[model samples]
Target chain A: MREAVAVFRKQILDTRKNRAVLIQFIMFPIMTIVMNSAIKVDDMPEFFYLKLFSIMYMAMAPIVSMSSIISEEKEKGTLRALMMSNVRPASYLAGVGVYDFQCCLIGTMLMSKTCGLDDGPWWRYLCVIMLGLVISIVLGASIGVLAKDQMAATSLAVPVMCLFTFLPMMAQFNDTIAKVAKFFYTQQLYLALEDINNVKIGTEGLIIIAANAIVILAFFVLAFRKEGLTNE
Target chain B: MISVTGISKSFGDKKVLDGVSFSVEDGEIFGLLGPSGAGKTTLIRVLTGQLKFEEGSAMINGKEVRKLTGADKKKFGVMMDDFGLYERLTCYQNLKVFADIYGVGDEEIATVLREVKLEDAVKKEAKKLSKGMKERLRLARALLAKPKVLFLDEPTSGLDPQTSSEIHEIIRKRKDAGTIIFLTTHNMTEAEKLCDHLVLLNEGKIVERGVPKELCLRYDHQKRIELVTTNGETISLQMDRENAKKTSSQIAEFLKEGKLSTIHSKEPNLETVFMELTGRKLEV
Candidate 1:
């Protein structure tokens, strides 16, 4: 447990060192929210664009942060060094995931504020951010394990992030797409947040969030089991 | 003590290590001398429990290295050629992290950094340090845990001569302090200076094993004798044991005639012995 925290602290320090990560953590959310608001469609409600903006920011954060963890460590050979230290695979993953998840959560908070989401019940907003960040972190960690390098990680993550982002956007346009996007993790978070804003704690909304969390948690465990045992 | 018996490793179809066997006694510096791609690094990795061999077993301190648990792993220190340091971390922080991982205290970190002569630069980030400083920092980290066995693979590969000597001095000190060192180096001089015992590895097999002087004598039969004449002309003679009596007679005649000025016998170095054993030069 102490080793995990040391590794986690190291990752946080490394993230702090990277200027681009800082910008992605801080500026991107602010920029996304401003852009979404500036181009609000005439037929669309104000809250609709804000909700979409929050979901996009939440989804992007995990992919970028998680991919960077593996690629940067692999590049520096830090992962190899850590492996040499005899750190357990589970602890290493937890350390890296926690750091990335923290980044995602921070980004989610900034995006929520920029979208003027303060009027909603605070606990629901917190739950939505937490759920979205966890799912994105799992997906990001899976990508980190699979990608070979920084370029490879980005190349793979861009399409996945785009797909997730586009799924919700597609749901906004077509009822058929909405039905399909309901199966996506971020879509579940989006619906849950929308329901919370309407003060309607629908049983389906609760189930969707709980089910997405369980599935992602299971995938995380499975992914760690598969790729975490071997040191690259 | 570390004992490796008939260990072999292959990546895909290419065999990297082939039935290599050796043992390292406690409190002795054991050198693995070989050319590049001779499986020196792979062999070191296996002994240090960082890699698993396809065949054979390595017993480190009476326990199979491959089967070492987390507690057992903390007893060994390793420094490969690639000293994967965190660039953003200060020298102190880097050492601190490893010390923490090993559950050692801050005093050990200070002691190690001081031993490696990095005390002054402990506060400086790794990326800002020079190459020699980086190597020292790596050495410091490796020694921080007070490991029972130390594995060093080309530990001084890229340093300047002065810095290399400094690093070697620290290694010698460690060996003197009763740490069993498993060292792999292509530098024959390093092997000659530090190794109490050595194994010459060629293509993953032990080609030669013994004390440096003994191996030199066993493989290189012809001795190079250089004599300077009174007229300042130098005469060289290669003498085998069978021809030594005859050569001594000739040298005695030269001395009697007041023609001999200086005399010295030249035995083969580790490099020559290595070439004689492996049929190749140590390339880097």
Candidate 2:
């Protein structure tokens, strides 16, 4: 636990020193709120703000910030330094997870409050948003492990951001896209957000969230193992 | 303080280390001298518990490497070929993270920073540090825990000669203070100057192992002598045990005739010895 906190503290210090991560963490949600306010649509859908907050910006921000964190460390050999220390894989992952989740949650809250998109009481909405954001953070971590460097991570991240952002944002308009989006965690999150008045999770919602979390988290474990997190 | 027995490692069908074994005494600097493909880094990795070997055992302070727990791990430190610094953190911050892990205090951090001559640059971000400074910071990190055993892989590989000498001085000081050092380098001069005992590795096998000067002398059979005459003429002679008497007679005759100005004997150095054994020049 002490080692995990050290890794977490070091990761936080590193993230602060990184300009690209700073830009992504601070700008993604702010851009969402600013755009929402600037482009005043006459007949905006009630769930439009939800999609912007959860799908377009909140989801994309953590992926950009967290994925680059891992890839940058790999490229710069900082991760190798951490591995050489007494830091275990669980501790390292937990540290990174804590930082990424906290940062993403803060961004989500800011977007929700700034856009006045608070559906129910803050706590209930926060719980649901956090579940989806966990998926986003896991996806980011998996990208960090798989990519050889920041450039490769950015390449992997674009498609991921697109799938999570556009697939759900545009699903309301297109039939085929909506059908495909149904299987995505972001789509389930979008559906959950659309009905903020009654935010009880159902069987399908539970399955989708669980599946996304499991598959991505499993991929993270496999990628880290292949990268020799335990062996060498 | 460290021992390895019959250690072997293979990457698929290509064997990188084969039946290699050596031990390092406490307070001694042992060098693993080899060319690029000689598996020097691999041997260091195995000893440092970073890479697992397929056969045999590596033990540090009488504790087997494979079974090392957190407490056991704290006994040693390693600086890999990559140096592995957090480039985004400041020099002090970088050391602080490791200090926190090792349960060390600010006084130790300051001492190590001063030891590596990095106290002035403590607040500088690592990415902005010069290559030489970066290497010093790495060495400083390795010394942070006051480790019982230190594994250094090509620690001065790319530095200027002066900086390399500075690093060697710091390492010598550590040895004086009773830290066992396991160093790997392709630099024969570094090995000759720093290592008390060294093993010459060729393609993952121990080709030669001994004190550097002793090994050089053992292979000094092809001794050559050069003589300059008073008339500015030079004579070269190869001396052997069988012809020693005749060579001395010839030299005496030359001196009596006042034809000899000066004479010198050339002994084989570590570089020549390495080439004679491996058929490859040590990379500069």
Candidate 3:
């Protein structure tokens, strides 16, 4: 546990020094706020701009951040150093995970404020937000483990970013997209958020979310088991 | 002490290490000399417990390598290539992380940085350091634990003479302190100068093993004697009995007539022996 704290502290300091990550954390939420004020229509959903950008942020922030940083560590051989210090794999993950999950929570808050969510009850928002963060982070971690470097991690993540971020946004209008997007966990997260005011999040929606989380978690474990930290 | 008995490892169908065996006692440097792909790095990995072998046994500090725990690993200091540095962290921050891992105080970080001559770059990020400085930082990180066994994989591959000498000085200090140092390099001069016992590994096999000069002398089968006369002329003769007998009176007359200015017996260096055994030069 002390080792885990040491790792976590190092990661937080590293992220603080990393300009690119700081930018990613703030960029989308700021963009969401700008878009919310600029684009307004009568028939549109209650918080269309907030919803669209928040889901996009969910896909982009945790997934890209975890994958890129973890893969970069592997690429640079820094992970090997940590392992040499006899830091357990779990401790390494926890250290990085705590900071990464904090990023997700903070990102959600920023995006939530784009609408009037800052004043509303936030418990339900957090419940689904936690689920979304887990799936994306695990999926991202698996990609990180599978990739040999940052470039490879980005290559592997681009399509995932597109499918998860854009598909649900398009599904808001098209019936065909809506039918297909319902199966995606990110889309289910959007629905859960949309109905949070009325507590109308469905059992079927919850099942899809849990199932995707399980599948991505399995991939993460498999990748980690196949490649422990870094390959020589 | 470190010990290994017939360790073997393979990736897929390709064998990276095959039936390798050696042991090192305290206060000695064991050098594994090989060209690229000679399984030097693989052997280091197996001994360090970063890699596991399919056969044989390895023990370090009286603990089985395969069964080593995180606490057991605290006694090892490894400086592998550039893979062990955090590029964005300053030299101090980099060492601080390891210091915290080793449960040492922050003062030790300053001490190690000073040891590597990197104290001046305490606030400089690792990526901004010169290659020699980066290597020094890596060394500082490895030495944080004051380890009993040090594994240096090509610690000085490319550097100026001054920096390399400084590193050699530090390594000598560690050896004098009774740390068992395992070094792998294609640099023949380094192995000869630093290693007490040298093993020549080629294609995952030990081709030769002994003290540096002894290995050279053992392979000096075609010994030759060359002489320079006072007339500035040079002549060569084999040390074989037949050749020595043929040239004895001629060499005696030259010596009596005061023509012998200089004489040298040519013995093979480690490079020649490595080439003779492995059929290739050390790759720079």
Candidate 4:
């Protein structure tokens, strides 16, 4: 636990100084706030802009930011230094994931506030979003563990990022894409968000989100088992 | 203590380390010298359990290298070719990461920084420090845990002479404190200055291993005397007993004229030993 916190502390300072990563975290929240208020259209779905930007923030921030942070650590050899210090891979990953997870939750809260969903038990709503965010965090960390360096990490993360971020946003316009995106955690989470407004999260939506979380976590464990042991 | 026996490693069909073996005892500075691509770094990686080996066994502090747990690794400090540092963090922050890892207090961080003469740069971001200072910070990180064994891969690979000398002094202090230092370097002068024993690695195999001077002597097949003339000319002579009488006349001419600035047996250094054995320069 102490080691995990140490890595967390290290990563917090590192992330603060990294402008590229910092921009990723702030851009989404700023966009959600600025755009949601600016686009005052008539007859729009009650929380359409809030929900759209929240999806963008959740899908992109955690995965891209986490993967890039990890890959930067690998590229600069900070990961090796951490490993040499006898830092367990799980603790290191957890530390990194926790930072991204917390940041994304803040974004989620902002979205919830912008949507005025806080009158009820907002913490429970946040918990539901937290569950979905785990999939992104773990998937990002898995890509990070597998990538050799930042460029390779970016190369590998871009497609996965697009698949998760765009597929759902695009699914709104295309029947075929919607058929496929519904199964994705981001899509299912969006469905859950819509249900949050309706005050009734669908059982099937939660099930798909939970299933996606399990598979992403499973991939994280596999990636660590296969490559984490090597000091490379 | 560290020991390895018949260790071998390969990637795909290409072998990188073939039947490599060596041992390092407490207070010993064991240098692994080789030219680029000679598996020196691979040996360090294998010993550190960073890279797996295909054959043989290795142990550090009585624990198997591969079986070493995270707790077991606390006894070791390693600085590799990468010199991994959090460039965005200050020197103090960088050391704080390991200090936290070892469950050490801030005092230890202060001590290591002072030891490496980096206290002045404690607040300086690592990326802003000069190369020599960055190297010092890296050394300070390795020393933060006060580890029993240290694996330094080319610690002075690209430093000015003064900085390199300072690092050598730090390494010597560690040796005096009974740290078993496993160093890999292409600098023959560094090997001779700091290594108690070293091995010449070439093409994934050890070509020579011994005390620096002894290995140099072992390969010093050219038995000759070197002369420096008053006119600033150098002369090399075969120094066999058969030619001693004639050479004495020559030796006396320079000695009598007081131009024999320096004279000694023309012994080979580690570079010559490396060349004679592998036919490759230590750093080409």
C-alpha lDDT of all candidate models, in order? 0.80, 0.83, 0.86, 0.85
TM-score per candidate = 0.90, 0.92, 0.92, 0.94
Question: Model 2, residue A71: displacement in angstroms?
Answer: 2.2
Tens-digit lDDT string for candidate 1 (B1-284): 98888999998898989988888899999999999989999887777676777899889899987788888777778887654898888998888777777888989998998899998998899999999999888888888878888989998887899999999999989988889999999999889888999999888888989999888888767677888898999887868878788888989999899888899877888898878877898765
Better of 1 and 3 by TM-score: 3
CAPRI level of candidate 4? medium
Worst 10 residues of 4 chain A by lDDT: A192-201
lDDT value, residue B78 of candidate 1: 83
- For model 1, what is the C-alpha lDDT against the true structure? 0.80
lDDT of 3 at A127: 69
Q: List interface RMSDs for the candidates, in order.
A: 1.5, 1.6, 1.3, 1.1
lDDT of each residue in A1-232, candidate 2, tens digit only:
8777888898789888778887777776777778778877889875466555666655787788778887877787767777677777678778887887887788878877776755564566678888887888888888888888889999999998888878887898999999999888888877876766566667998898799889988988888778744224
Off by over 4 Å in 4: A225-231, B257-259
Q: Give the least accurate 10-residue stretch of model 2 chain B, judged by summed lDDT.
A: B75-84
What DockQ do the predictions score, one after another?
0.58, 0.61, 0.67, 0.76
How close is candidate 4 at the interface, in terms of C-alpha RMSD after superposing the true interface residues?
1.1
The digit string of per-residue lDDT tens for model 3 on B63-135 reads 9999999888889999998466777888988888878888999888888888999888899998899999989
Off by over 4 Å in 2: A117-120, A230-232, B225-265
Q: Which predicted model would earn the best DockQ?
A: 4
TM-score, ranked from best to worst: 4, 2, 3, 1
